[model samples]
Target: MTARIRSVNVGASRDGVGSRGRASAIDKQPVASVEVRDPGPKRGGLGSGVVGDDVVSRRHHGGSSQAVYAVAREELDHWGGVLERVLPDGQFGENLTTQGLDVDGAVVGERWRVGSALLEVTGPRIPCATFGAWMGERGWVRRFTERGRTGAYLAVVEPGTVSTGDVVEVLERPAHGIVVPRVFRALCGDLEAADEVLGARVLDAQHHAELERSVARRTP
Candidate 1:
């Protein structure tokens, strides 16, 4: 089974996840579906936000999949029709919402079909201060680390347009079980956790080195 996209909503901040100022369920018809929008001279649109449709990543700006998880069609519809209560303070800012898929189990390089658009699990999006700023708390980043429920980033594998109310199904799984959440936990200030992450082999050389450095700093 796989989770399907119930709808797509984009805003500076989420008073709700849909157009009705409320979270739209998977069934209630998506208000605004998300797709990779290409920008010309102007940099800032649907796909890449500020840096345009390119691989430009800074602190909190770039093409990163917000939330990827498994849910039921009814849950999708319920959220679409009403407010979604996920965060500690209760707000919504999901790039793509779906139903029934083990997202944490997903691995890098694995591709999935979410409507016409094909999304590949590129890597994990590192949490930064911007997320904490959005939450109105300096230590809100700790919530993710403490909870160990960080989401993964998706890169468009095939050029196809995606819309609201599209079904999301997993097409592949990684050979290893080193999921995103595990990576997040391993990246914490703890050296042991960082070493665990180093053993995962999911991270690239740069990321691996970064983790190694972080771990070494804590070493005696």
Candidate 2:
């Protein structure tokens, strides 16, 4: 499926459902619809050499309608294939609604092109309370972080320019043979699952340290 740059609004909510209460009084910045592209030198550089491009500036709650990119049914199907599940129409909070791409399997430091703009998978989503609140679940954030299924974060690698209906291709997966889920599970604090996650060696330094800690804890 392909995704297009749609209007983006970040107020205390994406749906504009609930009031931001006093939060808006302090920091009142209306989220604007920005064309998804490599934000250029004004934003950052495009490559593994550019560490500053790692910053993710947007965070929205509820109202999924006004997001970075809006996906059509076909694009959703593409994302669903990667997810291994049929996704609801227009149900992603992505700046780039991608199709035929396994976004989750993308390991750290992989880049792909969306139209002319290049985006790279740099990190995973950090579960937050607002997301849980938006999901209408009290503990969704905890469960989400614990599950470690959050999609990876993408950094603009090449400052081309991205709009809607862009076809996304998988430039790379972990050639290291270690999956992201394995790292998350190994550090998820679930002993049984941790064992399975740590069953294999992970290249991430943080994960390797955690595995060592887990082994030490179990030994005693």
The best candidate in terms of TM-score? 1
Can you list the residue pairs that collide in candidate 2? 1-75, 1-99, 4-164, 14-63, 15-63, 46-157
lDDT of 1 by residue, 1-220 (tens): 5466655534332334333343222121134545453221112423342111222222233433322222233433443343333431113234554546555566655778876677766455554544445444446566545755545566555546666657676788777666666676677676555676687666656568878888878788
**lDDT score, candidate 1, position 134:** 45
Q: TM-scores, in order shown? A: 0.63, 0.51
lDDT of 2 by residue, 127-166 (tens): 5543444345556567566646655455555555454445
In angstroms, the error of model 1 at 181 is 0.7
Task: Report the CA-based lDDT of candidate 1 relative to the real structure.
Answer: 0.50
Q: RMSD in angstroms, all models?
A: 7.6, 8.7
Those runs of model 2 whose alpha carbons end farther than 4 Å from true positions after fitting are: 1-92, 190-220
| Weakest 10 consecutive residues of candidate 2 by summed lDDT | 61-70
Root-mean-square deviation of Cα positions for candidate 1 versus the true structure, in angstroms: 7.6
- Give residue 129's lDDT in candidate 1 (0 to 100): 48
